[model samples]
Target chain A: MFVQATESSTGVSHDVARLGRLVRGLPETALVVDAITGLGTTDLQPDEWGLDIVIGGSQKALMVPPGLAFLGVSEKAWKLIERSKLPRFYFNLARERKAQSKSEVSFTPATTLVVALHTALEYIRSMGREKLIANAAMLAEATRAAASALGLGLFAESSPANALTAVSAPAGMDSGAIIKELRARFGAIVANGQGSMKGKIFRIAHLGYYDAPDMFALIASLEIVLTKLGHTCELGAGVARAQEVYLGFVEQEAQAAQAGRP
Target chain B: MFVQATESSTGVSHDVARLGRLVRGLPETALVVDAITGLGTTDLQPDEWGLDIVIGGSQKALMVPPGLAFLGVSEKAWKLIERSKLPRFYFNLARERKAQSKSEVSFTPATTLVVALHTALEYIRSMGREKLIANAAMLAEATRAAASALGLGLFAESSPANALTAVSAPAGMDSGAIIKELRARFGAIVANGQGSMKGKIFRIAHLGYYDAPDMFALIASLEIVLTKLGHTCELGAGVARAQEVYLGFVEQEAQAAQAGRP
Candidate 1:
């Protein structure tokens, strides 16, 4: 099995299309993709990418409580599962697939969470999936722009994630201090780096249920937090950059509408 | 140096009092306890037990979302943290302690979750901590009794947890089937076993935001699911046993009140 856990620790998504080409060489290999944080952040084509098994969680892009998980299985994966020797029960994909085929679940489904996920899915559908993906990408672009405006460095040197922006902390200043000030002073909660990267970087997420106004508020708060932490920068520089990103999108939409007018 | 992660995967709580005795021999060692699921499930005496570091999450007994985590530090633990060489940043307990000393958090705190936790804490206080622990214990006892009445076996043989009851599936029957039927037929969501124990057992949680009526309803549903799954049992057997447990508690409380009358 070729297991590819997409979406990095810093929120960067892997190039699955490139990975798919490699998988084509190993025709018999089962490709398992962990799309936990990738689903709403970017456009994913499992079939096109030859992704055999794609896993997702409800908490991230689905905007629900943590309990339910989703899986996308291909025909090749189903055949592989049939011949697999792994002793499985609760997480048995074949069992779930059989039940799903009958419009049911193999185990006790998280009913409340399923309802919440359904509602979130409906909202995403209404907004259009392509538009939702674009919204995340645009917000991520805005965040990167804002961070640059604040004279901060990007943590992900290559293939930065659309779900969140990881920014390097200023020299000799702990990112934890910035995170602390944001919450204490303005009640804004941002994530600091995980594991070994802690204190070196901070992350701001713009994926799923986030919009331009939320980005504006976050950037504004960030600017205040950075200043409070003794980082010398002009007030509203980050917010202004983010605002420009939003305005650019609005302008594009307006021009598109005008071009299509009867 | 010496860390102890308390709380079991099966929801059982360890005997901290006994563990504390062992820790006393190693004076310089830090006693780190994962009290995430143990806090509301059982009586935890951190200070008295000389527990150096006690960790907790907002979910489980706290009845909040799964973003916020809390830590209780001791003076002895602080000394260890000061000299610790382990590369630390986001989970730096020292930084959190320092920030908390000033009524702040070291990272972007989950603001909404913190607020919800605060409300939950207030409710816990109103109900009284001892009473809360007793409630979980009572509910767990009732569940065990009900399961026994239904001819089901307990998974935890020696140290059963007050948070949840793990029950073994009947011979030749998959617990997953029971879990599925419960959800599909009655909208009740119970958890099946994890890993190796899957298909053999199921778990029913009695911790956090649960009452006697909830237990009654759960048992009633379990009876229906078991019957539908070809398990031979008298209808309402489990529920009747649960009701008896509740009635016993009421009788005891009435007797206590009568004895207290001057």
Candidate 2:
């Protein structure tokens, strides 16, 4: 069964653990997860949660350039691969695995990209995976808080994604205008809604390769853009709110570390 | 209307100036130059040569990761774009130029890659463009000399590119085996020939972000891999030849500078 663990367009993450529980009832079914934008942002335990396959992209939380996609295929998925009759060529996972066994690629891989990914992975390891996750989550929370403080409504109500925050444009205002103003006036470019949601919502990304200062600068630029577009909002309102949220996160982490002290 | 100026597959570069002269003969024609692997490794005067369009890739001479491609479109090409009725959206050079004029992108740009490219560009500027090209040319000469010293033949008969050296593998020896041995024994990865040339030739790259020590190390590894693969070549034979070529280049440059003295 194919499932989108994280919907990139809407920035909504599905509960993989709960999905795993449901998939367990169907013994013949193999769960495939689209974790392209979810890998580094959320806590996804493919092994523990019994996920058959998890797909990832390099440009997301990996902090590397695009052109590389990663697949985590469990032993269960290997059995399916052995029996599956799908037409396969360049994306043949089995062939890739055979080459990987020899610490090589089946074809001419993107050499410089692989080198960049290696550096990015090393950086993630040095930062501690849990802390990196926490950092992303905190940044996402700050973005939400900042948007709320600016009197903007979030597009994702039920389950927001840590990778990005999708906020609705003010009533009757085109999100494209705000996006344009942000780039033209402030030299900041945020994503406008895709497809049907275009001109209705704007997104602020807080995924890998982003930090507190980036979020702060984004929020500040957003405030300036919004105000210039005739939206009545106090100056520095979003930035101040984001700063408060970030400081609160740091304080909570510090307190938790202090409590865990032996 | 479309022409490949630099053929990276065979490490051959066509004379763009000569091609431009022919292209100018046809009023409606526009010359497009593929400078992907050629940029930063050679002196390419697009403006002076009247090239209409030039395409470059970030992963090559820019020393950045992939996912970003650069296009240098002349005013002539812009006129062609206005008249040419091709259904264009993502790869639309007109839209890209508009965005670039404002120092922005039409879509979500590769943020980390752009930042890295900025640093790499700054480094290149500090090194001076002409000197960088000279360095690559010298390195290419050394690689060719080293390959020749090992009794390997050059693949490109005319206009060899400074970016990489394509040399034929020894008689009855597979280039793939040499590439494999290099990676397996010394953790050094080199490129084997592509397509019909597979198992026949090997490539040594001397593009951007590489220097003397890098070439020296690569030559040493090649010697080791060749010896291990039963090639009856003396150890350090290739390295000594490469060192001699490099020193000769330095001496020529020094003598040229002295001759130019006022």
Query: How many clashing pairs per prediction, in order?
Result: 0, 0
Runs in model 1 deviating more than 4 A are A1-262, B1-8, B255-262
Worst 10 residues of 2 chain A by lDDT: A105-114
Q: Over the stretch A138-217, how does candidate 2's per-residue lDDT look in tens digits?
A: 99999998888899999887899998888999998999999998888878878889879999999888889789999999
What lDDT score belongs to each candidate, Candidate 1 first?
Answer: 0.80, 0.84
Candidate 2 CAPRI-style tier:
incorrect
For candidate 1, the per-residue lDDT at B166 reads 86
Q: Estimate the lDDT of model 2.
A: 0.84
lDDT of 1 by residue, B1-262 (tens): 3333333446455677778767757857877887777778888787898888888777778777665667888888888788998866776877877788889776544355667889999999998887777778889899999999999998885778888888999999999999999889888888888779889888888777888988899899888888888899999888888888888987887898799999
lDDT of 1 by residue, A92-161 (tens): 8887878888897765454556777899999989988877777888998999999899999998757787
Candidate 1 clashing pairs?
none
DockQ values of all predictions: 0.06, 0.18
TM-score of chain B, per candidate?
0.92, 0.94
